[model samples]
Target: MILGIITDCTHYTSPSGEVCTENHILLRQFKHLSAYFEKTIILCPFGKFDDRKVTTTYTSSNIQFHQLPLVGGNAMKDKVQLLVTVPKWLRAFKMLHRQCDVVYQRFPNNLNIPGFIYFWLQRKKVFATYTGTWSGYQGEAASYRLQRWILRSPFRGPVWVYDEKGKEQGRIRNGFSPSYSVAEWEEETAQVEKRKQRIENGLTTYKFLTVGTIIDYKNQLAIVQACHVLKQKGFSFQLTIVGDGPMKAELEEYVIKNGLQEEVKLVGKQNHVSLRQLYREHDFVVQAPLKEGFGKVPIEGFFHGVIPVINNISMASQMIGANERGFLFDASKPNHLVETLLSLPAQQHLFAGMINKGRTYAKLQTLEAWAREYYETVSAYYNEA
Candidate 1:
């Protein structure tokens, strides 16, 4: 079978003439999914090496990339570029679309305007993965709302959502993004076990990590505020905020002004390999996003045996597993994060069991495993026909 993916994922080329992406998680998925089919055609907006987003390369062995002209941010300036570029890209994509036996369209993207509609019109076997907040959220784009609206009941194929089980919303089903492999999971868990043995003498400094683009909705600032609170109480903790965005400077400013420079570090995006090391070195993964889809970082943290202190989001609630896996805090409540962290040292002893449960849960959430589940289900639909 030939697999065609329509994604809004921006890809950057590397110095060695390789098709690479900063999103190593997506890169792994692409490679794994391509292995299941004779050929995989990726239709996405591609950019040059100067884009500075290169990390891991996508497989070119049995994969063909049909590029779309680079479309940048959601601003009007970015949208205007599409008016002239999208027409030719649509025509090009239509030609590529005919060769695919199945279409896997990742959602809430500018290309989804054409990608989803064209696939649906052609009556192709479409597997839509809504990678954003599936239940909707505040200040969401109309495009996002429109995607959810159309993917409702009787959408002809599965609508993979971030939520656990994706409930009974007709075509909507559970889908999550994964990063680690089986080998990586084993290595991390082994390290976690070793950590339990070493840390029995009791903890010292609490190492917290938050990975994602530095953004307002991501609520990194709130975590910083919590850090300031911890500093005031003379807590021995450091928050390393990984990944860069528009809000990095603002976060840096806050960190410096509040004399939190020593406590909070806004480290820019790291490659997949470095990210694993970061997870291992840290004690806890803290994310309090105002809205989110299924974040892979927590799953990664869990696999690495780091306790996940997540906020009130669907993914967090599902993965917290009645607080046995990790702790959950309300992002809406002011000082809630600070309060949660303050109580952590008191409950530090119970973290090992929680980490074990989290590891057990995350072991099955590897890229290879997710690909197997996705391939089987989507391929079976075609088999039935």
Candidate 2:
């Protein structure tokens, strides 16, 4: 069967007119998922390419790219463009719906809204992957909430969501996204042993790392503040902030202003290889975002044998295994994160079990496993038809 995917995942059209992406996670995921279907049609936003250092390429032979204009924000221009492009979006999904046998819509996305409607009206075999906070948050866009309600309440379409493990009834299923492949996961056992020894021996210098676009919603500034607190407390630790964004300048200035230059290193974005190495070297992955769907960093950290330290979000407790696998803090109070880290010495005894459980979870939710399971779930659901 041919699979159709509509997502906000950005694909880049290079200066040479070739389509590729720096989103290695999605690149690997789509490629692997394509193996299950005869063909795949990916309808996504294609933007002007930034000449980034790292890229995970895609071939047009098997997976076709259906480009859509970018739609975001609440500005007047954004609203006008969103309105004007309605026809393009509708026409695109209408065309795709006829050719594809199954539709995989990545939801809580503006672009996928039209596609979701087109597929749903036709009663096409379809499922959505909503990778955002499912249980509502303090400040969420109306469009986001509307899409969530549509998928969860009105429509009974099967969806792979996050953080709704047991509370999810009917077709609403919990899911996770993976960054590493099975071959790379070969050393998981050995890595766990090394992590156990390091934890049991007690860590003198803690290394904390967070990787993502330096955006406000990401709350990376909170991380820098936590580092400042740790430094003042005379804690010997290093904080590494990876990935670049509009707020990079502000974060840099904050680090310089607070005299956290030595303590906090905002190294921008690194290539895939460098990122993997950084994950392996770090003792913990600190995710302080105000809200998140799955907050994939912890899962990626789990794969590399790095524990998670996250702020309380929808999935925080569940993903952290109720603080058994990792630690959860209050984002409102940055010092809560400081307190969590400071307790490491006394809490060291819980490390081995946590590390083992984390790695085991990561291994089970690999890219292949995610794709395969999604395929199986959607297939089994369609079988009931």
Candidate 3:
């Protein structure tokens, strides 16, 4: 039987007009699997948005986009899958099953129940890969509990996780053992590197960058408030917020209302070229997301030698690593962020050390490495079966 690999919400085209997904945790895993099943993989886009338009990047041999049904505008909740037409999803399912004997899907969200029902009824071998629980959605613990139900399902195959922490979180929430050993991940990309800009007036100002959308949960207001506090302390610095979302109007109002227009810039969403340039230009990336599954911003910022100043939550706390690689702050506390920023310039040498450490870390993870591991796992599974 020809081996067919299937994925949901895993492929993204880069800004350079290449069909590469965002190089976060799940994308890294998908890239690995793509290389492994070079010939038999079929990919589906289950994400809510696709800003870039690079459909041609899929390696021709195995890739397809099965548009996932979007739930209503509000934050996602349970029974969301019921709103979508199952027949359309089923057509994609049937197509995937017909092409290959084994199917692999990155799970959580609405696809869990439908995927399980389809594969079980068809008697197709299925693998459920869990990256992290859906924290972006509205409902709390019960939402995860519902997703975990499929994890314990008999049809669920080898569950792939990024780190032991990810596995533990899944197990704690779902009460299931990880079916396979986890893989090491790093955040490095071959995108065009931005030439470092020289800050002629040096050593006095602390510049921080906040990437991603200006959504409410991103907690950008906290950063602005912190910058205001830092400015009051005679600290000369700027906080450049990259990316745009619906919260733009509200955030702009807040910045103007507080008279922080000079100190904070709502630069709006930038393309990849500009984004890399932003990373190179800033001393560090500030991430204050209220919640995150696994933060790729910190890793991506570190990859470019920009230290990440992240909120103490989710994987950001674990990845910061004893403040050696980056700094973690209480996102809920603006004054704390101000204090950290004030203290950072004094540790210039330390910051340099962290950047060096980040460079070393970046080399350890590459597209080639990710692809190889995924291929071996799939090949071994099919071989044994």
The predicted structure with the larger TM-score, 2 or 3, is 2
Q: Which of 1 and 2 is ahead in TM-score?
A: 1
Candidate-wise lDDT, in order: 0.83, 0.83, 0.62
Q: Write the per-residue lDDT of candidate 3 for residues 146-254, one digit (tens) a residue.
A: 6666665555455554342545432222211111112222232332122122222245667789988788888887888787777677888888988777888888897
lDDT of 1 by residue, 1-385 (tens): 8988888787876778788777788888888878899999888888766755637877559988887788767789877887888787678668766788888888878777676667677887888888888888778888889878777744578777887544755556777888888888877656888888756668889999999988888989999999999999989999999999999999999998999878788879999888888988898999988888897778888888888899968778788888998889998888888999999989978888988898889987888988888898887766886
Top candidate (TM-score) = 1
Candidate 3: C-alpha RMSD to true structure equals 6.2
Error (Å) of candidate 3 at residue 32 is 5.7
lDDT of 3 at 258: 79
Judging by TM-score, tell me the better candidate of 1 and 3.
Answer: 1
Q: Is candidate 1 or candidate 3 better by lDDT?
A: 1
State in Å the error of residue 131, model 1.
0.4
Preferred candidate (lDDT higher): 2 or 3: 2
For every candidate, C-alpha RMSD to the true structure in Å: 1.8, 2.1, 6.2
